[model samples]
Target: MRHFSVFGAAAFACALFAGSASATQEPQAADILFERPQLEKLKGGDRLDYSYSFKSADPSLFGPAFDDRIGLRVEPGDGPDKKKVEVEMFSAERRRAAGPFEDMSGNPLLSLMLEENLQRLAAIFQANPRYMKTAIRLALRNAKATPEPSEGFGDAPGWRVEVAPFKDDPHKARMHGLDTLTYRFRVSEAAPGEITEIAISARDAKGDVLFEETTRYAGKH
Candidate 1:
């Protein structure tokens, strides 16, 4: 049997909806662009993987190379049974100083600029969709999600995923820097394999909403 991830099935459904009329519409910047999720069945259990790309409406004002910050939250089951899971998909820390600068050893301004440049490079690296995808895959692979017995409910599946936070650095700092964001996923045997709802939201460091979208899942299972 051919198995698919929630995102993969969703993409297929989207493609079907994109009839000839869609071809005529000009491409515009979307708040979020997500790739189909890939499902992997292992000896232990099943895994789902997905990634997204986003473009802020005001990127230039945010930062020279700033991209949209994406967030993912997964809740399994209905209100009573629902459990919110936190997935750490991105780092929240700024870049740090590069290796020791030999030529410009004494100069402070050059050294500061060098550090900033390194931070920019790091930002670009993290922003790369490919890099982010690979990182997510690796994280899932290394995760030890061993199911444990649930309280009051016989043997229930429960897995824990540990994600390391970004390292704290003293040197690197930028004005109006982008807030670090994280992503996570959740699955419940009781809930349908399909995602029931999808939400996209953007916020500043102060917790102000910049953009938000909440809707029922349009993708197929």
Candidate 2:
């Protein structure tokens, strides 16, 4: 597991290592780069969104794979205090590749891959605020080493993240023979800016949250 704060033009990268594999097949990893959240100034409040780009760390090992992009939305509530905020996130296949995993339109395996990526992206977003509170907090609790803060949308003062694990049946996650059980959580936040609080969670099978560190943003408690 790895973690880092995402702010500014500097990219936040993480590697997803494939679980155990056959001797003939070497384990591979995918490098994912998360762009800083982009803030859009709305009439009443503001809308903040971000993008995630990923590729195989070793193309030869994984072959040509499609890159992915996810979009996140934050809608502020009415009134000066803005007590409620609406949060949404989604991912779309940017480019398709010609290979066994191609034509993901109807393939369950490929579709599951896309869904997993989106869920992972959402988890990162949900963990942002708490991850920002204390450098040591992120490192000790979340397994994310803190990075120097740079100029970016999420760099604003008072920004925070909160995550709550839920009790539910484990989700079945499989890709290219790699299988794992994962739990779900409800991640929300009330940070600086127009966002008073966001309510959203990655659905089961949407993503895996194993070994993820989550906590309430400092000052919230």
For each candidate, the alpha-carbon lDDT, in order, equals 0.28, 0.25
Compose the digit string of candidate 1's lDDT tens values, residues 1-221.
Answer: 11212112223234322432322233211101111121111111222222222334455533422322222233332233232322222234532222221111011111122123223334644443333333433333333333333322235443223322121212114312222322222222322222222333445567665433232222221
Best by TM-score: 1
Clashes of 2: 4
Candidate 1 residue pairs in backbone clash? 8-37, 10-219, 87-183, 87-184, 89-183
Model 2 TM: 0.25
TM-score of each model, in listed order: 0.28, 0.25
Candidate 2 per-residue C-alpha lDDT over 1-221 given as tens digits, one digit per residue, 9 for 90 to 100 = 12222220121111112231223332111110111121222222333332222344333533343433322222343443222222222233333221221111111111222234334444544433322322212221332112222223255333233333222212213222112222221111223222222222232344532222121112110
Weakest ten-residue segment in model 2 by summed lDDT: 27-36
Give Cα distance to truth, residue 91, candidate 2, Å. Answer: 4.6
TM-score (C-alpha, index-matched) for candidate 1: 0.28
